[model samples]
Target: MGQQAMDTFRSCIPLFQALSDTARQDIILLLAEHDRLTVNEITEFATLSRPAISHHLKILLENRLVEVEQKGLQRYYSLSLDPAVAQLKALIHTVETTCCKESF
Candidate 1:
């Protein structure tokens, strides 16, 4: 890859850069409850304003951390099943498993 493309790819680390801890935890929790959610549902569930949810969704979407689907007039968001998202989850799993080994 070209330097610019490499830089852009590195800049888009959804597992790290796309969200703060609070927002990331919130998104994870919401996904656990429902496989998919509309922006309005997220806003209501998170107790965040609509605009705030929109902004977070934009970042998550750009990073491929979330996927979107259209349902008539509504748009729903869900965890992406793409490679990057999978890798991110795998990384987290590795860390958790390592920690468990150390504790036991």
Candidate 2:
């Protein structure tokens, strides 16, 4: 692989890792549906404890997959259609078109 492709693959690792957990996926789906929600609001639909929810949120926050809104004493989190998702799709395309192309 060229340096550029390798770099893209390397960067995609963290984004994929962040999304690999079921809890995080659930949180993302919930955020997608609601647009924005507080931690308590997210926890209400979750089977995990508040701390676990916070932990999942932290991972999502670090990945830049979710945005935060602070209102008075509350913090609201919302899903972001991030650049990372586009980058990931591009990387997948690069692989499919090159390494795994259909035989002709």
Best prediction by TM-score: 2
> After TM-score superposition, what is the CA distance of residue 75 in candidate 1 from its true location, in Å?
0.1
Estimate the TM-score of every prediction: 0.64, 0.88
Residue pairs of candidate 1 with colliding backbone atoms: none
> On residues 1-104, what C-alpha lDDT tens digit does candidate 1 reach at each position?
34544444454465476656677558757866798999888888887789888888887787777788999999999987475656665555555554345642
Q: List the residue pairs that clash in candidate 2.
A: none
For candidate 2, write residues 1-104 as lDDT tens digits: 67767787888888899899999999999998997999999999999999999999998998889988899999999998667689788898767766675853
lDDT, residue 72, candidate 2: 100
RMSD of 1: 6.9
CA RMSD of all predictions = 6.9, 2.0
lDDT of 1 at 68: 89
Please give the CA lDDT of all the candidate structures. 0.71, 0.88
Runs of candidate 2 exceeding 4 Å displacement: 96-104
